[model samples]
Target: MFEGHDPYLVALSVVIAILGGYTGFGLAARIRGTPGVSHRVLLAGAAGFLAVGIWTMHFIGMLAAPIPADTVYLVLPTIISFLICALVVGISLFFVSIGEPSLRRVISSAILLGVGIASMHYVGMHGLSGNFTMEHDDSMVLLSVLVAIVAAYGGLRAFLARQDGIRLIASSIAFGVAVSGMHYTAMFGGHFVPLSGEGHHHGVSGLAASQQILSIVVAVLCFVIAAGFLLSLVPEPRRRGARDSAGETGALAPETDAAAVDVVSPQRDHAGPAAPRIVSAPLGGLGQPQRPAPVARLPLEGADGTHFIDTANVRSVRADAHYTRVHDGTRERMCPWSISEAEAQLDPSLFVRVHRSHIVAIPHVSFVRKEGDGAVIELDGPSPHRVPVSRAKIAELKARLGLARPHA
Candidate 1:
């Protein structure tokens, strides 16, 4: 029984509502940067559904259809509808910021949702052109609310599905298709019309309904296809260099059992080279192998019982420690020490720690020899092992051996 309404205004209102919802939802998704397309697609679908729902509700209410003057109505329904729609839009944004969500997200979403509801109510109120009353019919309103809730659930599920077995792109496409279907189906049942003015009021009917239905189906199909396209662009997870979850490469995966681990200081390879190698231990009596030499202890004692240590406590073995030991026609090199100790006896000019275990005798050293790996100690001593300084005695070795300090 409606008449004299502008069809253009009615259509424009719906378009604006949809745009607002779409913009709000998509903005949230972009901000979230969630790992998959499902979240983005869900947000897009939610925006569309919310826009259509709000637009239909407001437009129908604004139609001012004939009602009994005595019919009682409460403002609560409008409030509830707006609140629900706003909440749907707000949560859509929440799903986007999935990584370590900040407290600000909650606050901002609440504020945005509140504003949306208020704006919807005002827009609906202003669209009314004549005196009319809303009826108190719980069934229809409840049905609408339930449908919106279902739509929301579907949207949430679609977003969450990305975390499950579903492929990211597939989840997004599925969500989009579902949202499009739900939106169009809900819109089809809405009793909507134009705002009354110079033109007679009418909405989708006959060919218009057919066209709208076709458009909705196409839109939904497009949404699903677009979601698939977007998902294809997501990057695949990379394999970590040393980690293996399934032992796929035939190597044993490291156990994830340790809750706490130690951080050992980096060892200085001054006594020897940094390269890892295999060395056999000296054979003991009765052809038994001697235990491998223990790493030279730090804070070593010099023959003269002098203490010489690096200020930083970086331990190094002397060069003499690397000399070969021969026994029973078998010759074996001593366990290597770090560079600082190696330099103590090897480079006479550079190495001057002169004493027992103090290879660098500064006074005895006349010149220094530098090598790429480390410097070699130069001394007049016929015994090489006797000249290598220990980690603790380099300074004493230098002082006794009459060595000059190397240039910085």
Candidate 2:
């Protein structure tokens, strides 16, 4: 079984395994919390990378084996095997992406993915034809499938769990080993038998080994590029940073609402940064509204570092779980503070709480629209930022924006 094992080709297969594992991890990152067409497109790209990478590795290993001169592979069966691997992987990724993270779901996805991998291996083996016939040890075959299942499960857990870079790298290495191990183990369990043939018979015509490898490499590259492009389309969450005055650890400070004061018209000088626009003042003492104060700066924090965001550039702030995401036109950053906390610090005249989890800056708000039982506030920015308004806040939000309440 190991007679024709080429060291260089085996090394190449290992490299492919590593690349596939890393790419799969990246895909998992992009898939989380993503919806609509983007998710589907990214899933497809991931599936292609994983499936093709595995399938190509397997075939390369086979090619490394020193086989009888008369042995040849059928083109049609090989293609079918590739397709089966890709389809199975694609479905597995879809299932994992859509399903909640539970023991049952994880196990089910792992089993499906393992079965696909095993099936692809055997089907590819069936493509081999010539004066020699191949047979596999049933126990070894079962063992290989089991290994695949366990590996797949581990990989899925690592991906679905917290996305730490170090953890992901470790899991990718383990997964690569599992993939390579299964192939070699299955090969170890197989033995070839001589056929009762006399003269050498020509087998089905197919591409040379070099051509096949080149094609597979090209296909994998295309899939990887497509996946990267799709991921790039999804905006990354931004981080806001503020330095502590005492030279302590930097943290995001809750925004303080600006007090009502005399309003000054905003001036936009193309040569410098844009000036903060004056927001409408809230109704004040004796029915005489005070002037709105200008918002100057915002403190933000991110995974990379801290940023003191300019208030003039802020488009909106969205609540995600316990943290708030601040969108500053181009990108968004995660703030350690909650929506309510952040709202309290922001200038009330400029930023209004539309929902328990959402706050929109008045200058960035484009329009408000009634949808279903609630309302949606749209922001003017590079991307559409729609903030949902709770029914209770609908009237207040409309009044603040000076828009007439939509009829029920």
Which candidate leads in TM-score? 2
**Tens digit of lDDT per residue, candidate 1, span 1-408?**
234334554443344333333333333333232224665565555554444444443533333333222222233443454555556565645533454333355444444543453345443332222233223234533444344444344444333221322333344343333333333333334342434564643232222122234335435533543454345345555432222221122111111211111111133222234323223343455443332332222232212232333312221222222221111111111223333233222333332333222323343344444434334454432322222323334433434444654223
| lDDT of every model, 2 decimals | 0.35, 0.67
Residues forming the 10-long window of minimal summed lDDT in candidate 1: 324-333
Task: Name the TM-score of candidate 1.
Answer: 0.27
TM-score of each: 0.27, 0.57
Find the candidate with the highest lDDT and give its number.
Answer: 2
The sequence of per-residue lDDT tens digits that candidate 2 reaches over residues 19-71 is: 67767666765564344677777788778777767887787787677767656
